[model samples]
Structures are given as C-alpha cells and as structure tokens.
Target: MSAVPGTVQTVGLFAGQHVLAELEGVDPALLDDEPFLRRTLAEVLDLAGATVCDVISKQFEPQGVTVLALLSESHASVHTYPERGALFVDVFTCGTRAKPERAVELLTEALRPTSAQVQTINRGEAEAPADGHREGAS
Candidate 1:
C-alpha cells in the first residue's frame, strides 16, 4: 500500500480583513432565481480575486424561502434567505484589503436592501493567528 499523505502547513503573509455584512427584509424571489443569484455571487467572488469552491442551496416550498451559500478560499461567502428577506454575507481575504470592500459594494448593488448593514473586521499580518483555529482565516 502507498503511504498516506501528511498534512502540510504553509505560512503566507498579506494585509486584509474579514468582513461580514447582513441585509434584512429582502424579497425571496431575488434568491429563488438561480441564474441571477449565481451570476451576482460569481461577480462578487471574482472581484475579491477568489475562486468558487462549492455552493450549497436550499429552497422551501409554498413559502418561497431560499438559502444559498458560496464557499471560497479567498475567505468570503454570500448567504441569503429570501423568505425572511434576510441575507448574511462573510468575506475573508488575505494579501488584498480592497477586495472585501469591493465585494460589499458589489453585493449591495446587486442585492438592493431597504436597510443594509456592513461590518469590517481587520485581519492580515497584523492578525496572524496560529493553526488548529480556523481555515481560510489566517
């Protein structure tokens, strides 16, 4: 039998932040439409210089509620729940700080909200954390 591969730990440096933005009271249809949601999501990730790793979505019947999650290594994701008109967005990027800000702007434009809130958490070399804590959050 071949030997099992061991975990590799690499340390990279950069300056950026982990941003989490949430919007409340959004129309479910906005998320129910797959094409529109996917397009917008892809655009946001592209702006952050991130690649789309995977996506998981769930839609409810009758109520027309939907939840979408876009996972990425660039440290960002867009989560949406249409039924409740709510959206939860998280962006974590290293080596690039402006990406997250642009992501927030792009999302806000794509997803128009009655009242939207944005919160930015500074991350990067200043906040270099150890291993075993969290991935894509260095």
Candidate 2:
C-alpha cells in the first residue's frame, strides 16, 4: 500500500544521546579507575532508561578514563578525570525516544559539583531517510 499523501513517513524514527559535563571535587583516582567507571556507567544506563549489556573501560596514566557501554536498545558512556574536574558523556538510543539527559542530571547531582557545565545534542534525526527513498529500499 502507498503512503497517504502529506502524511509523515515512518522510515526511521529519530533518537540519540550525547552530553558533556564538568564536575568538581571528585577523586581523580576513582574517576579514572576502570572499576569505578564501570559501576558509574551501569548506574547511568539504569537511570537513562537503558539496560547495559556490557561495559569496556580504559584508564590513562595519571588522570584520564574512558568507558563504553553496550546496551539493549542502545549505548551509554563516559570519560572522566578528577584532576581536571571534567567528564564527557554520551548516551545513544536508536528507534526509541528514551531521554538520556536525565542521567547527566543525576551524575551532576551525585558528584556534588561545585561548578559544572552540560551540553546535549541529538545525533541521528537529521539523517532520517526521506519518504520517497525509504518506500522501496527496505
């Protein structure tokens, strides 16, 4: 069946996760530690309405950390450094409208940051396929 005229196409629905945060007073050792990063990633995923399937983390000497989480519907991640008082995070959910920004909010609150900054961006919407291109391509 052909799509009704003027109706919005359902080729690929839009959704994504991305946020940058600045935090203060955290222990660099803890933040840059793999175990800590994994625990934090799990909590963040739960709070973001996503289920974490697996987590991989890497630590940089002195003070830097990165974590990647593979989730059921999507993924959530973070990079942290207590020495620099900074954290970068990303949460991506595909085909669902689950809001991952709340995770950032929770983290900001948990860290009890004296000063912080947050930036969020949606990553996949603009690339949604046009109706004509979607109709028979699938």
lDDT of each: 0.66, 0.70
Local accuracy of candidate 2 as per-residue lDDT tens digits, 59-123: 88766888888977677777886677667666667655455677777766666667777777666
Report residue 38 deviation for candidate 1 (angstroms).
2.1
Task: Write down the worst ten-residue block by lDDT for model 1.
Answer: 63-72
> In lDDT terms, how accurate is model 1?
0.66
Off by over 4 Å in 1: 1-11, 53-56, 60-73, 127-138
> Which pairs, if any, clash in model 1?
26-85, 75-92
Clash counts for the predictions, in order: 2, 1
- Candidate 2 stretches with Cα past 4 Å from truth are 1-12, 126-138
**Residue 73, candidate 2: alpha-carbon lDDT:** 62
